[model samples]
Target: MAGAEWESLEQCLEKNLPLADLREVKRILYGKETRELHLPSGAFEAASKGDFELRGYGFEAAEEQQRRPRIVRVGLVQNRTPLPTDTPVVKQVTALHRRIEAITEVAATCGVNIICFQEAWTMPFAFCTRERLPWTEFAESAEDGPTIRFCQELARKHDMVVVSPILERDAEHGDVLWNTAVVISNSGAVLGKTRKNHIPRVGDFNESTYYMEGNLGHPVFQTQFGRIAVNICYGRHHPLNWLMYSINGAEIIFNPSATVGALSESLWPIEARNAAIANHCFTCAINRVGEERFPNEFTSGDGKKAHRDFGYFYGSSYVAAPDGSRTPGLSRNRDGLLVTELDLNLCRQMTGRYKMYARELTEAVKPNYSPNIMKE
Candidate 1:
């Protein structure tokens, strides 16, 4: 904004904004009552008989479809970067390991047919520092990395599909790097993969320094549940990214992201729902929670002093239905699992309140029916 407005905002933050008061307001109004687990950063670890719960918002399918509903219970896991915080290497991976393992076991018992982790989930969002060696060392093989291997076991055990997005180091291909998402099937088979087509240029997200735009275009994978696809983090801003996935016949597209609240909180819930309604597909938006402060300060080239803290990666993960309805978002300041059931036939049948409308429209419009006001 202009100079005066900027000064006013800073003053307001100084005088009126205490972190405690902000949190209290959230607890009363927005933040649902929750019980935090004591394990590292994976407190939102286990899911029992609807412990983390929300009322379903969308409509039910037709009677025929309802009798034999192709309902696939899906889960989205969002968590913070791990212990000995700010330090980006060995400890961080260990923390995520504990977190993912805990959640996977919980989700399987909870009947989640498919589950997805956040983007670059294996490591911190270390690309912000634009440093080498320390962060680059974390990139692992997409084919047989420790991360995918761990997830494969979980998928096989549960008979569920797993989408693990990570920073991939292609050792076989000259150690080149790409932001990739590995899709594993129920039988522990390594299904095909897709990469992040778009990289971010806003603020401290200087990802282009790490890897170029993904070479793998939007590709859909046919799993036992339905046709699925992955739209990695930054691409959520691009509508066509969502379009391409839908165009490729993706019935459910998961957007695994690592964005902060300051950058895109308002836009988060809006864009995904729009994609779902417009494309006639289910959209799952997953983000990492908590802050990962670096040891050193970095400037955003925005005429501001260098700062070590990148704003909080607020996690408000949710699922949107094809009919423009969504469930209540999960916790904003805590790591959590959002599990929701989906009927694949509802996408094809759209048997909600729109049932009669679909039927009427089909009857009203025929192949040769067109505007012929001139009595053609």
Candidate 2:
């Protein structure tokens, strides 16, 4: 048959063409004979077929075959900063810009495509009380915020997707405040924001004091790098939140947090790793480091008298893979950046191997046969 007159694979398969026609179609599509025929007389027949004639078939097959996985480098910046109220707002903004620039430069050198910083990257965790002025001063609109502008410049310069969490000043609605994480694409475009869904109000970490509950739902942003999601500090404790992000098609999720001391610190890795395993997604938890003090009396269990002293902020920034394996994070002792190469293809491989997302197949068990229970 002439190459132009050949039938498509779907047509050939559906029509159940004769062995000879099938061989001809296969040769036309694959550039070689791909079918064998066994005659009813117990005789096998083989025929030499020419090279494939359909360029479109070759293109389709090449596209269907999985491409080699590229290494996606990610960096986590674990740094310490005192409350934004403690320093001049301009000075604080400049300092944050400098720190972000330094980290972006380092990430560029390391070939990191996605860089995530600790929560409240532009300020300190000053929501330890009901007073709204101090925290409100730190909030800025995500579009025109100094921090967002700084991050956009860095992202454009380094060609990296920057995940930055900040106290967003929403000017559209009576200047309402929210704990928001802005995702900036590689080309300096704002993808979307994930608001801190679960606001915590326990002890010294009174997030409700300053910011209201996140109005935005759990959302995953699609970028050139990958499908990414963010869950702020307190939101990390909820499994449903992580699952929601995963269901929304997040391949890698970021958890930027700001909690001090051992109790909250201990729960960090556990929540991140469990989320990764359960949702079949990679999780990066970036926590702040150093000691943050609140000028108020606070007491933990054991009757230890304390005032104006919140325990140390343990900086344990870690990256957990879909297989539940994690890379050790930056030390709690000082400020540093943790950089690692993540193979996102491995997420699909692990999911396939463990059937993590194959609920339809795994849950398709046959019902038990019970003759005694059958109705007469």
Candidate 3:
């Protein structure tokens, strides 16, 4: 009757009650007849007389028939900007506009209902140069900016869900900048945006110089296609971020990122796959391609010192299933869209196989063993 009493039923099932006793509990809970009974003689007599209180039994067969199935198709687009090293920022944005249209056109042709762009896909990752420029002024308000308008139009034109990340200039807050991703619906409506929660300041990755930390908290937007979540760049490194999205009912998550060579590039696919397995959700990791360079820094070295010079963005974009298996990714050295079709049914199938929704006693002990000091 009570929620706590229902929980006791689960505990009793784990203890395996005698058949006669289990049947009596079922009869009391659901007014059903037991198909067969298996019990010791003593327990059988008590159950026959309704003297022994029964536990751990339910009419699961009836509930199974009422459940419905869900299915959806998702896609990811990964590409490189063809901007030469000396191109002006305005021209770079113009070039990106054409590229977005091209990628969206490809996605439409492939019959993808939802599409995503790599992180900061609007402009070349210029923070690596460590130089201030008037062009960085290209950053605009994510909601009404040129980038958002462009994506909104594409989503509407293709009748698809679009996830686009850009350098956002917070118009309301002294025009402070943030690394933000916006989700647009098939109708060209701006759903919401998630700013990069974790900013990296290591080596040549100077994100702090251009953008401040994001203020919009983690959000899972419900769409006609499905419930989806957005995790941008460095946010993927934090496990709790994925957990937040999962608990909020996200069936699909897009990790749009922009990072330099091997080490960080390698972590890109790793994080997305881990999130899918741990949360029983489909994940897509989209990355930028090609080399972007600036003055006072002849950084596009192809050999060993590649990571330091304007970091060559290795474009190995990929998609991971709920079972943690990854699809074929694009070449790390080339620029192209890595397309794949993911069945949302696989998420449900994986959950059933892994029992991710099934409660376990071990979970209660996890807090004691947790390595995060911030949790305490």
Candidate 4:
């Protein structure tokens, strides 16, 4: 079948596919809902016994029983691939290093305590080709990769926590590959790692071609500022993935992604925000900006070119707080940073002390049936 013909068929099938709840969409367009998420009393002190004020970001609450609000200034970079379309893998990595240096400098001046990079920040979104040459060669040992060392240098220099997402090559485990995130603490120590749990097999996102499902369970690292976790890329779509991080006591979760405008742009904003409010944790979504044109035309085994350009990776990176208030997103066409403040106490506010209205689309939409993904 022709590619366009297949698209038409898929669209026809999708019209009745039932993922779209028109009432919910209508409610989303017409309604104004509060986004406050609940945090049980004394959750901050309970999350950690270490002195949070020693870092110079918090203070004691007026009441002796109450802990002071923990504020973390986090910076998220929405960057474009810094190298040209035809650069060598080595040069591409070098260019990315320089780009992050510049961005992190700005973040430091703004007093950001923690910062996150976009998904696979060192490489282009070239997995659509499914060709193994230089792309596969871009993978590196997550723990000892040059990129990890590079971010560690900056982390130590700025005293900032750096979350770097990349393609990882694990030699100890049969040299298997995975999409991974490395957490570098403020003192340049490698805190730990989390592999992306979900790999997208739909359309051109065939990330499973390069790696299998992540084996490491959800982990939230204890940092100087707070407990944090990384839900790399496609994991953002799975509500359970976000819930696991929250369940593990993560106050903030950074979702580093590389998604184009043509695919799930509308859902991009809703999913992350809903997760933050639902899971009662701060959520940050960071997408790479700009279009990446691969060196050669590629085909999806379909007699025609699947895509010469992978389309624009619209970068609208933003941070959503537990209370549902969020900073405005960054630019779609430019490299940008969102340096925003987070009061971790909102995640631990006294239950029922504040009656913030959250959007209840359940009443507006039809009674839902479980999909197989949800059923199993």
Encode model 3's per-residue lDDT on 1-92: one tens digit a residue. Answer: 12111223324553697878876654443243312212235433433343212111111122234444354546565566677646777788
Report how far off residue 187 is in candidate 1 (Å): 0.6
TM-score of 2: 0.72
Residues forming the 10-long window of minimal summed lDDT in candidate 3: 51-60
In candidate 2, the residue pairs with backbone N, CA or C atoms under 3 Å apart (3 or more residues apart, or in different chains) clash, namely 31-51, 31-52
Summing lDDT over every window of 10 consecutive residues in candidate 1, give the lowest-scoring window: 1-10
**In terms of lDDT, which candidate is strongest?**
1
Q: What RMSD does each model have against the real structure?
A: 9.7, 20.9, 19.7, 12.5
TM-score of each: 0.78, 0.72, 0.71, 0.76
lDDT, candidate 2, 245-339, per-residue tens? 88788888999888775457557658887888788778888887766655454554346666655557777677777766666555564566666
Residue 331, candidate 2: how far off, in angstroms? 0.2
Candidate 4 lDDT by residue in tens digits, 283-314: 99998877788888766544665567776777
Q: Which of the two, 2 or 4, has more TM-score? A: 4
Give the C-alpha miss distance for residue 2 in model 4, angstroms.
Answer: 25
Error of 3 at 323 (Å): 1.3
CA displacement after TM-score superposition, residue 244 of candidate 4 (Å) = 0.4
Which lDDT values do the candidates have, in the order given?
A: 0.77, 0.69, 0.68, 0.76
How many clashes in each candidate? 0, 2, 2, 2
Of 2 and 3, the candidate ranking higher by lDDT: 2
Weakest 10 consecutive residues of candidate 4 by summed lDDT: 51-60
